[model samples]
Target chain A: MTIGADLKQCLATIKSIEAGLSSLAINTNAEDEQRLYHEQMMVIEEIKQDLMKRIGEVEREEEQYKGF
Target chain B: MPEWIHIIYRGVLFLILLFLMTKLLGKKQISQLSFFEYISGITIGSIAAEVIMGLDNNIWHGIIGVAIFAVIPFFVEILSLHNKKIRDVVEGKGTVLIKDGKLLEDNLKKEKYTTDEILQLLRGKDVFQVNEVEYAVLEADGKLSVLLKKDNRPLTRKDIDLPSINEKEPHTIIMDGEMIDDKLASAGKNRAWLKQELDKQNVTIENVFLGQVDSSGQLTLDLYDDKIQVPKPQEKPLLLANMKKCQADLELFALATDSEKAKRLYAANARKLQESMDVLSPHLKG
Candidate 1:
């Protein structure tokens, strides 16, 4: 698969993981576990954002190449 | 031979013979033994006791009695091993005491188990309610095997689509401040590697009360001094953090580059790195 496709797949996985962590944070009763899950969700969110930005850059470059 | 000397010799001989017989019978727990095995065990013990304490001068009689008891069971066990009929007769079939949340009254009567006894056994298996059990069998060994109803069963990793992880048993490489060379070898490691790991943690082997190499090849130490806390291994997490940093650096490079080709190259590599991280994140992530 192309790098853009790979990035999109990674973005989907990150989003799912972030959602899972969010669910875990909400479902758990312990304060420490909730905090840990929330922190992990935030880290995954940052990665997801980076992945989405890179996907956009790759797709944009591919479009420019097609024009040439 | 004097009376006391004869008794001592017989006692020592029977003890050794019984020990050998028990070893031949295999290492099954008492609760797991068949009816024949149980009877043989008790009979042999009683005969051994009788022969040891009996003031009679016939030592050959006691030896022959013990031999007959041991040899017969050994042959019976062999027959039971080869034939299903002998096995079933020796180890009676498990009675289905409960099926589909309903108690089999006839089977309970045959097994001479009261409802209260069944309930107590179910409680032992952590099942307080009868309707929660889909099936309950009274095994020949008297163990109650209860299968919970699908709705009542606890959720497992497979139920939630989680990948199964098979972990190997951890090897105890150090015990009482002494290194076990064989255990270290079993874990596929050596003295040089162990020394490097010990040095990395700044711990001396003599100070470690117990040291284990886990399935992931990480060394965990229990120091003799309780006040000192050893740091946990962070190799996987560290590698994950490094990958994230590299991806972020690439993204920064992509943004700073004036040329469009360099921007494309950096962004493409960043995405590739992210893909690699995605595959490893399950194992690496806390």
Candidate 2:
């Protein structure tokens, strides 16, 4: 559970949620309904991007603790 | 001529004529009948009854009268289809009893509905207070349509910005062990897909009293056999909280330990758990 490992796990969890939202969007055939599900996917994507930014910050700090 | 002979002949002839007349009329249920239709139906039925019972009254005269009554409504229904003004005249326009929380006294008096009667209708719609009513329309059928004030109204999905739900209706796939072909076709699914779903649930068509497939692909089966397995609801946030508690313990252990290697290992596990939980938090709130 190093910073690097933790960031990967965080990224994985967010990716799974994104995948679930994507499947929901794809399964709905109606254009309006697909749009609605994509809205939720968009919200989740925003969160995933925020986590990715946080991961970059964590990776920078991991340089300090690499030997320890 | 024998009285019994006349009774039987008139009764049988009128019954068949009544059946033919009603069959020509569209399949509008009693609730859907407009004021003109209701009166027409009653008049036609009364003429048929008079022809059957009144021994002296010429049956031909009664038949002609019944035909005229039926014809008028049939023509009126046809005319109403093409003319909106004629429809309004025949069916009558809905009168507004309450608008913007104010009682339209003139309209209510014109409709011959008293203050207490209007209040009763409002209460029937679950609006006990007059101030809560935004609009109350008295329809031609004498039924009241009440819309509550915006502030008093129940919340809709749009109010909270919830995503629009699937508009496709649930289709009955199976009923009484028989495949409903029309419903299945409407759902855009075939028998093979239905069988696979039933097989996934370990249910056979013979045992299924009813089966419906929703737009979300959720299949609901009701078997002739009363026994059922209800899915237990998940313990969601509680499960998350317990995991969080375990992570907290790992963090504490990492802080208290003397060995740097052991500390880093435990702390790393803790950090991973913390990140997973952080990612999960917003979903739990939503």
Candidate 3:
């Protein structure tokens, strides 16, 4: 997949996972699972930021290729 | 029961059926055809031959066999167009045989291609040394696509710092003395304008065989009786606007990162851009 398409798909997957994470029933004893989800969210955010930067780079490259 | 009757019947039938089947399969060059398509062609040909020779057997059965083979590929081609995964599965994937001038033995084995064969392919591409290849891939169609290392690669205008002309698609304005009104309109011209341009050449539209206009609005005409003369440029113009934009982007990116490496690369690119502009300055001025 192209970087743009991969970013879009990644964001879609993250959104679904976030929704599922919110729906999970947690108790006081479920601190470990909640912590894992928190870490996962942080990683997802990092990936989102990285993908955005890469997408910008691709767009710049494309602009350079234009008019010929 | 006559042999000649069967020969004529089957000959005509085969001609029509094979043409239709090939058309259904779509246009693919011999080298571009996948292994699946190649095998399918063999099977279809065998069935066709059977239909031609099988005078004692049922002709409908042979016809049905050919039909099934053609129909499967047609649907497969359609499915490939829609779904990438199916396309990859159906057509197979391009395998990387060499990376960074290193031979990938596992991939070569997986592809079932020998080193001698790979070398032959590379030689065909005018690549003498394996060390000169940065990347070599065996494409899904069984053809090799090689990316040579920097020194082995062709020098472009960017390498030598030369300004480029923006490329344009040429539109056919006239064909065989007939004005292609749609093409002329698409190029933002009319018949009246075309006739006026023809008058410039001391010719009429009726005498002109073919006329085309480029994106730069340069009209080239081929007369029915006259040979057209187009001069070749002394130095090919490179589009420095593209290079300037990239250099500007790199500058911005370097400023944002504050990385010495990025800064150095940006400076190098900027220098190259300036050199290219300088090289073309004389020509542009003239």
| Candidate 1 per-residue C-alpha lDDT over B1-286 given as tens digits, one digit per residue, 9 for 90 to 100 | 6889988988999889889877877775244467776777778888889988986647788778778877887888789889999899987788999999999999999999998999999999999999999999998888899999999998986888765544467899999999999999887778998999899999999999999986556788999999998998776576567567667766876887677976886687678668756655654563
User: Against the true chain A, what TM-score does chain A of candidate 1 give?
Assistant: 0.86
Off by over 4 Å in 2: A1-68, B1-15, B27-29, B230-286
Estimate the lDDT of model 2. Answer: 0.72
lDDT minimum window of 10 residues, candidate 3 chain B: B231-240
Arrange candidates by DockQ, highest first: which order?
2, 1, 3
Q: Candidate 1: which pairs clash?
A: none
Expressed as tens digits, the lDDT of each residue in B1-286 for candidate 2 is 8999999999999999988888877675245457887787788888888879998899889989988877888898899989999999998889999999999999999999998998888888888999898898999888899988889999997888754454667788899999999988887678887888778778789988988876644567888887766222122344355446646655765786665865776677667656655644443323
Please give, for residues A2-68, the per-residue lDDT of candidate 1 as tens digits: 4445455555655665665565456344455456556766666666676566667667878732211
What range of 10 consecutive residues in model 3 chain A has the weakest lDDT sum?
A21-30
Give residue B254's lDDT in candidate 3 (0 to 100). 48
Worst 10 residues of 2 chain B by lDDT: B230-239
Q: Which lDDT value does model 1 have at B79?
A: 90
10 residues in a row with least lDDT, candidate 2 chain A: A59-68
Poorly placed runs, candidate 1 (over 4 Å): A1-68, B1-8, B29-32, B56-58, B239-278
Q: Which residue pairs show backbone clashes in model 2?
A: A1-B268
**What is the CA-based DockQ of model 2?**
0.09
